[model samples]
Target: MGPVSFKKLLLVFLTGILFMSQSITVKAEAAYLKSKDVTLMNIGTQKVEGKIHLKGDSKQKQIKVLLIKDEEKKWYELPLKEGKFDEEIWLTMGKGKYTAAIMIHEEGRKYSYGPKITVENVGEVNPFLVPVKHVESNDEKIIQLAEKLIEDKTTDREKAKAIYDWVTGNITYDYEKFGKHQEGDYDNTYGALHTLETKKGVCYDYAALTASLGRAVGLQTKVVKGQVSSELYKGYHAWNEIYLADENQWIFLDSTFGVGGKKEYFDKKQSELSHSKQEEL
Candidate 1:
């Protein structure tokens, strides 16, 4: 080819590549908004509101905002107006996480933007205060155990002490092996049966197992999630609350503490536990 023709072809190829690069950059950037521009606030009890500004070529299209509750597997969509959107979400006080997203429908395809919300425990309410439906048992072994632990002759304090001792002595705490993973089974009783059979579990598993066993024996029990600020450790922790039928109040029992090879026992009243928040069940 002639030198002039070759130079012209090279310039055309470079121009085409630059245009394609810009187009790709715009498309990639369209799916997400600037994170710093989004605003979120916990407005009132059980209510949170937020605003997200989305940037994209199809910004004029109708946008939908969703607040997804992980535990309940539910979604809440917000109303759209003009270029900005607002969302008001109602949440329960529990130990779980939530995610918020902005979705836009264009050319029959949907695109979503930043997940801008992370909700922790919202309020403080004892889980044991909620009414729990009693489960009747016909198993001979379970019935016999219940009868021995829950007979009319047993005082509330004695019953609670017995339950605490059984849980501490029977279950081994192993937190390292039971860290929460997104795909991990969390049927609330994931390790309960195994713990009952093998007598070993992590903090959460032990609390859940203890709660289940306590309920089986006709005592109201609940699992609580919180942060422990003891001398040895300071981080996320799990424990249980047992309703003292005679005293008409719930008491915190730390099976993990006992399982940690310590003689210290946690018979503190529910109000006395160092909990930033509490979630039921």
Candidate 2:
């Protein structure tokens, strides 16, 4: 009960309060550092674009944004520079419904994951930049081919016809592989590069190569998958639908069935052909 005892007790109490406050602040800061804020800049029919505003300077750390898609159930990561990043971080994901989430990963470990953002098929995705697994539009060989093929072609239609001619003329149909694929003995390597290397492929490869080449030459192109009926049989087929920016119209091309540069399927309408569309990519 003495004055000195009272002073000592008061001093200890003040010190304990200060320590608790410091601990609380540290916890709050840690929580803040473990989370981030994301704002979508733009969402197009075919594109999902956004920016992540990080709380502190994460430049030195290996910060990345993770994009999870429903179709593939894959985690696609885009590295963040200077505490922020844009949609260019992700490779072109074609038109689809995607549940996208932004995550911060640092030092080989995931630090935080934001709420999932549902981005439906927006609109007008840039096909030139978006790439499927095997469809490498930016490949050196594809780029070279695109540049060379269009060197003399003047218009988009002309360029498209030229590409269609080259594919139908050069690449052969892989009936053997198609048979095997039908029997369920398939691998995941079919795309533009495969068709280019082998000079033969099924509908998937043909469509992918066409899209790749088309996109490389500054044309917006997509691979359309669905059913087509022919004299022999009715089955699944893959082809291309290219968007002519100048014409503002989407035209169809069937390079696989157009062997020998047949113009029957080129620029044809859906009602004119026995083709039913299932998906566009």
**lDDT scores of the candidates, listed in order:** 0.56, 0.69
Q: Which pairs clash inside model 2?
A: 44-122, 44-123, 45-122, 45-123, 46-123, 92-130
Model 2's alpha-carbon lDDT is: 0.69
**Tens digit of per-residue lDDT, candidate 2, span 179-221:** 8978887844588987999999988899999999998888888
lDDT of 1 by residue, 103-160 (tens): 4444544545643444444444333432122111223444465456556546766776
Estimated TM-score for each candidate = 0.46, 0.60
Worst 10 residues of 1 by lDDT: 130-139
On a 0 to 100 scale, what is the lDDT of residue 29 in model 1? 63
Judging by lDDT against the true structure, name the best candidate.
Answer: 2
